[model samples]
Target: MNGKETYDKLKEMAFGEGIDLFRIADADCFLDSEYEGNRPQDFLEDVRSVIIIGSVVPNGVVDPLPKGRSQYTNTLMAATALLRVASFKLARFIERTGHWASIVPNEGSEFGYWYADKDTLRADLSVKWAAYCAGMGNYGINQLLITPEYGPRVRLTAILTDMVLDYDGKSMPLISDACGDCRRCIQVCPVQAIHEDGTFERFKCKEYMFSELGGLRCGLCLKVCPPGSGNP
Candidate 1:
């Protein structure tokens, strides 16, 4: 199949499998000087497409927040697990079609945290930025991709492949102008890691989740997000 044909087939398969969002981005999107994360090309030889596939973490799972962190964390992991299976199957299909495919770590992946830079606490690449580049959403002040449909409660996995596909460039600002003056996430953050200026203290967040919380994922920022919280 050609690029468009492959793109359509993959997208259909993803949605048919209950994945909520599916968008492909040209691997060169990472080459933009503004993107600071690891480049897709470095991860795979001649990587031509970054297939971003994800599903929204159910609002039911997010409502408890910092109160039930264990439940929240487990649900997030469950979501991640589902993505892994789907992406694995998709990758296998791609390879069967004569292209190489690989899956990147998503939320709740210890591999991502383990391989991350110690000082920066950043993974090999920013999956949120990859999602944004794919035109799936804009970044919120909390630094999570805020899709118009799901807001910040989305879980994403990236698939690197040599299949060239039709995709869009970044059409919105790096950060959404729509979240103006909204401090819900900052106010909800226990560690005060999020700042008004849109930057966050990754170490503080990491320490809070892994150290203070005993490895439970903090969903305060996600829980308080306006668009997806059903409170706005």
Candidate 2:
């Protein structure tokens, strides 16, 4: 298939497999602001395009805050799994077409904690940034991609391919301070980690998760986000 044909097919495959959103971005988007020591070129030297795929996080599964732990974890895990399988499938298809494809890990890295900034948890190949670059969404004050449909309630995975596809060139406008003087996420945070400004204390939040949630992820902030929280 030609480049456009291949791109269309991949989008079909992703949506058929339950992907909530799919987008393509030029790999040059990461040339300047890569996380840690990893760059987009590091994944595939010949990479010309990045495929971004994401799935929605069910609001019902995260609405009750801490009480929804089991459901939330299951939903997140399933989203991650689907993204991985889709990435592998797309990568194999690209290889069969005589091109190179590199599937970035759905989870940033095994040692993500090591690089998690004390100010805000960030790791290599940040899926959030990739999604933004792909015109998928923009960042909220809480530092997560806020899609117009799902807000921050989404999980994303990326695929790097050598096939040159048309780039979207940051089509989505910046969300810039969409929280609109609202501080629900900050107010609901049990650990007081989120500041009034657009940043948060990553260490305090992580500690709260480890101690109270028994996991590295706590949905308190996500639970209170108006855009994605399913709240009226």
Candidate 3:
């Protein structure tokens, strides 16, 4: 089957399970060259297309502490579960078509520096950015992918396949500057990690996550994001 037909079939599968699939040509997609090198052969072997999926976290699930566990961590875990299912389904579909499909996680590849070298790491595109590039959504000021339906409250997962697929090329207006005059996310940051310019200080956020007492994590940014606040 051609790229467009393969993509259509995959879309139907996703819809059957109530998941959304967005497609973009693997070659045309731009990733962080620093983490993901320009050498396509290194990370992806004959990757014809990339399938991006978004999972919306349910509202009212954000809590600093619930009983003894952190609610934010629970939500992330839930999102991870959703991604796993979707990716596996897509992989199987692609394999059935006689093409190799691999579900690569956002984290570094399985192979050490040799197969998935550090350069590939630098070139690795941010999950949110990849989703946006795939025409799945737009970029939010907090560096999160904001879907029209889910806002910045979604987790992204991807599937790489040799199966050719129709490209969406639909670029959404970036909202990276949406914080324009508003700094709600910054003002509400418990660790004060969010900068006035809407840029996040990763070190500050990481420290907060690593040093939090009782091991409870915080998703202040995710919680404060107004998009997924209401049910769709």
Candidate 4:
């Protein structure tokens, strides 16, 4: 199949496998980043396209968070695991087409994350940025990818491929500058990790998560965000 045909097939397969959102971004999407140490090309030298896939977090799982943390942790774990499986499946499919494909590590980065100095808490291959480039969604004030369909209640993972695919530019727009100025997350936050401005204090957020929340996951902001709550 040709590039467009192949991309359509892959997108169809992703949605068929329960991916909520999908898009193809030209490899150059990461070229303009100020930091060059971990661009998409850095991982796969021949990569010509980036595939982004997302899954929504169910409202049922998030609504019960204040009562306990197990539901949130379990739901996130399950969703991320599904995303990894989807990435692996997609990569294998791309390889079958005589192209090289690499799945980004979901949990940790190959390059160590420097939290204090750089505020890099998680992994390399910023799937959030990739999703934004693909036009899947934009970052909200809370520093989470907010989709029109699901607000911040979604998780994403990506695949880097050498197979040339049609770039769709951006299919989705930013949900809004602020989530209707709800500010529930900013108000509920015990440590004041989120600010009125889009800037987030990740270090404080991390410390609060570890010290107070027992390291499961503190999604109070995610819970109160109105966009993904089926309101929008």
> Sort by lDDT, best first: what order?
1, 4, 2, 3
| Clashing pairs for predicted structure model 2, backbone only | none
Candidate 2 lDDT, tens digit per residue, 199-227?
Answer: 66767776776677676467777766754
Give the worst 10-residue stretch by lDDT in candidate 1. Answer: 106-115
The prediction achieving the highest lDDT against the true structure is 1
Runs in model 3 deviating more than 4 A are: 20-26, 31-42, 63-69, 106-123, 213-215, 227-229
Candidate 1 Cα lDDT to native? 0.80
What are the lDDT figures for the candidates, one per model? 0.80, 0.73, 0.59, 0.73
Candidate that beats the other on TM-score, 3 or 4, i.e. the better one: 4
- Give per-residue CA lDDT, model 4, range 1-232, as digits (tens): 9888998899888988888889888878778553233576665678888898878877887787766677777787788788888889999999998888888766411111232235466555667777777777776667677776787788777888888898867655544555765788789877898887766777787777666777667778888776346423
When superposed on Cα atoms, how far off is each prediction in RMSD?
2.3, 3.6, 5.0, 3.7
List ranges where model 4 is wrong by over 4 Å. 33-38, 107-119, 171-175, 178-180
Candidate 2 lDDT trough over 10 residues, lowest sum = 108-117
In model 1, the runs with Cα more than 4 Å from the true position are 109-115, 227-232
Q: Report clashes for each candidate as comma-separated counts.
A: 0, 0, 14, 0
TM for every model, in the order presented, reads 0.92, 0.84, 0.77, 0.85
Question: How close to the true structure is residue 96 of candidate 4, measured as C-alpha lDDT?
Answer: 93
Candidate order, TM-score descending: 1, 4, 2, 3
| lDDT (10s digit) by residue, model 3, range 1-232 | 7766777788877767656545564545654352342434457758766678766666666533333235656666676677778789989988987888877564211111112334332324344555666677775555556666665666666777776777776466666434456566676667887776546665555556657633345555655565324447
Clashing pairs in 1: none
